[model samples]
Target: MTIILKEVLESEKPILRNLYSLYLHELSNFTMNLNLGEDGAFHYEELDDFWRVDGLSPYFITLNEKTIGFILLLERPFLKKSNDYGINDFFILNQYKGKGLAVQAARKIFEEKPGQYFIIQVVENKRAVAFWKKVYTGLNIETNERQDLIDKELCLIQTFKV
Candidate 1:
């Protein structure tokens, strides 16, 4: 499959916002256990907050111009001095999962967006932990894997200079 990761444009906000609900729905499976809003909406307000964040780059993961997922890459990693980038959020639709599309998209994104990367996954999300391990390993680079304490919580973080 030919996959592309294009930076989300302001004119595409509605399209991106539509995908926002799906992204959050997929993440509902996380340890965070998302709960729907009263109006049955995914409360897309968070998207606005993320957009307003400095150094945050949002992309629409598309397969032939059809949106399938979204990725929020933080140009300024949380641990400022430790790593230069971060994946604040990432999600692919259920039907698209396990198809190796993400890994391919990530490779392209990594190539286009270069930096010392830092990725943090909640310890309880074994799927994320496993997925990232595979992605980094696929990168064929030396990575420093460690546990990090962020916002009074423990998370598994991998740091690597790409």
Candidate 2:
């Protein structure tokens, strides 16, 4: 499959917002921070900052001209001093998993953004850790890993340079 990372435009923020709700729901499986709003939908307040803030990017991962997932990339002063860039959020529709599409999409993003990178998986989400490990190994990149706490939740972080 041909993977494309299309930079999200300001006018497309609503589309991204919808997909982000799905991403947050998936994330809720491992983190306790998710809660439904009065509208019975998940919400991400800082999502709008991707457009307003410098170095924060939101992209739609497309295949065959259709959006299959979304990726949020963070860079520079927005993150901790350890890495220059970070994969802030990534999600592929459930139907698309295990076909190597995610791996391809991730590789494409790494190619587009070459620098020291940071990726984290909630420690409770073993599948996420495995997925990142596969992506790193497939890219032939070595990583420095450690455990860290964010919002009182334990997470596994991998740092690497491309």
Candidate 3:
């Protein structure tokens, strides 16, 4: 399948909101083993809050113009270095998992806009740890860990030095 990753347009907010709700619900269910009440109604208000923030560049993963998933790429100042950039909030729909779409999308992002270092955070939960291990091992990435605010949660930061 030809998956297209494109910048989200303002007019597509409604559809993107619905897709994001599905993405969040699936992610919560996968990690927490329970849905965090990410129904359409609950997400509608949340999406409104998200849009209010500036510098949030959300993208849509589409197959023939139909959005199947979404990812938010935010360029923010790094805590380690004030001049560096960070990418945050990446998610894909559960139905589209195991398709290698994320790797392709990430490659496209780097190709279009290169960075000195690309970092992604993985939670310390069992599933996330396993997933990140595969990704890091496949990509030969180096990682470090730090304590997160939540108990039993750690910030597994993997960096791609380019």
Q: Between the candidate structures 1 and 3, which one is better when assessed by lDDT?
A: 1
Instruction: Please provide, for model 1 over 59-126, each residue's C-alpha lDDT reduced to its tens digit, 9 standing for 90 to 100.
Output: 98999888888888887633367667888788888788899998988898888878888788878678
lDDT of candidate 3 at residue 133, scale 0 to 100: 60
* RMSD (Å) of each candidate, 1 decimal: 2.5, 1.1, 4.0
Best by TM-score: 2
- Tens digit of per-residue lDDT, candidate 3, span 56-141: 56778776776767767655421355323445555666666778776656555655655544454536345545655666566565
Which 10 consecutive residues of model 3 have the lowest summed lDDT?
A: 76-85
lDDT of each: 0.79, 0.90, 0.58
Clashes of each: 0, 0, 0
Question: Per-residue alpha-carbon lDDT of model 2 for 27-102, expressed as tens digits?
Answer: 8898778997788778999988998888898899999999989999998767768688999888999999999999
Q: After superposition, which runs of candidate 2 have C-alpha atoms over 4 Å from their true positions?
A: 80-82
Which TM-score value belongs to model 3? 0.68
TM-scores for the candidates: 0.84, 0.96, 0.68
Ordered from best to worst lDDT, the candidate numbers read 2, 1, 3
